[model samples]
Target: MNKKIEKCAILMVSTDLTQKQIAEELNVSVQTIINWKKKDEFIEFKDDYQRKYLNNLAAKAIRTMDKLLTSDSDQVRYNAAKDILDRTGYKPTEKQNINMSGSLANPYEALTTEQLLKLAGDDDG
Candidate 1:
């Protein structure tokens, strides 16, 4: 909770500097940084900072994906559109795989004629 530990946690979250580097920058020994990092308050602050940082990064990535939807390359546009859809809970429906305890006399009995054709990838039902 001290100003020094707070600064250390902020540096640790905001930059790619190692603890030793941060200690040198802050005019403290690496041992001090390591010790402060192990404290409960330091841990809590660092975890919250990291979580917020990641959330911001994810937002940026989503924005980038949205921008990529207008790209000239068809493949890039398609992939970005798919990524956005997948992230926004618009994923393509997938057939469920059901397991039965025992074999049935006719496995296709439960399926309609159209359903059977669709499952077989048939041209006509």
Candidate 2:
């Protein structure tokens, strides 16, 4: 592969720069970068770069979480445990169900002006 394309792939995964920024850094037009993205080889390289980059990031995060879990500070350990649980889909959240049947018109239209004002955090007086 060309050095420019290799550099572009590296810049893409290793930094948060936009295509325009990368183009500017590489002294190429944004369209040229867009064209590179459409090419099969460039697409494959970018996909590989992104996959490896994300894997490395996940590994680092896991290592950090492990360290935090073993921390002497109760708050740190608790936070780490909560984060792990949240990421693993073990955290509990309130579920709300709304009845949207044809028989049920907009609830807002049924409310009294005072009730609407109260709901809006304005005094009803």
Candidate 3:
């Protein structure tokens, strides 16, 4: 791969710059950058670079978790703990698991005619 394409891949992941901005910064045409992106090597390089960057960031955040949790500011501690928990897959929303076997008959179909009609807001009584 050319050095410029390598540099472009790094810039694409490490910065929030648009393709036009990157082209201007690198002194290359926007089409050149778009062309490089279509290459398999460029795609692989960008994905690997971004994954490594995020892994490093996560490691750094984990290292600072203790300090953040013990910070003097209540909001800081709360936010830090919440961030850690969220990253660790803790969700505040309710989760319901419904088991669906091959058979269609289940709890939902057990309702009586009146019960189903009432639920549908069609009950006249």
Candidate 4:
């Protein structure tokens, strides 16, 4: 909420300036920026500013991607096409890796409640 911290957050997200550079610009020590970076206020402000900045650029980015589709390089065109397809929900199907750590087969499939509890070392009945 303070002007200094708000300005710091804007600079952090909207520019490629390093923390040292931001500290220099703000007339603060690098350690000050480093300290501020760990604060919730700084993190929230930077994230909010970044979201707003990207949202504002979305249309321009789309236009650039569309233009790139006709680029002279085949790879560039293919990449642009692929990006557009991905954004439009035409992404390739991904193979999911199922991790079954318990057993190769259903370890307790043949067990009754009493037997399963016994296997689990919960035979308190």
Arrange candidates by TM-score, highest first: which order? 4, 1, 3, 2
lDDT for each residue of candidate 3 in 1-125, tens digit (9 for 90 to 100): 78888889989889999999999989999999989999999999889989998988987878799789999999999999998889789968855445676453455577888998898899793
Query: Candidate 3: where is the Cα deviation over 4 Å?
Result: 86-125
1 versus 4: better lDDT goes to = 4
Please give each candidate's TM-score. 0.66, 0.57, 0.61, 0.67
Per-candidate Cα RMSD to the true structure, in Å, reads: 10.6, 11.4, 10.3, 7.5
- After superposition, candidate 4 runs with Cα above 4 Å error: 92-125
The C-alpha stretches of model 1 lying farther than 4 A from their native spots are 95-125
Which residue window of length 10 is worst by lDDT in model 1?
96-105
Which residue pairs clash within candidate 4?
none
Query: Each prediction's Cα lDDT score?
Result: 0.86, 0.88, 0.87, 0.87
> What digit string (tens of lDDT, one per residue) describes model 1 on residues 12-116?
888999988999989999999888878999999889988988888987887888889999999999999888788789989875555585443565889988898
Cα lDDT of model 4 by residue, 10-95, tens digit: 99888999988988899999888888889998899889999999999999999999899999999999999998999899989875
**Between which residue pairs do clashes occur in model 2?**
none
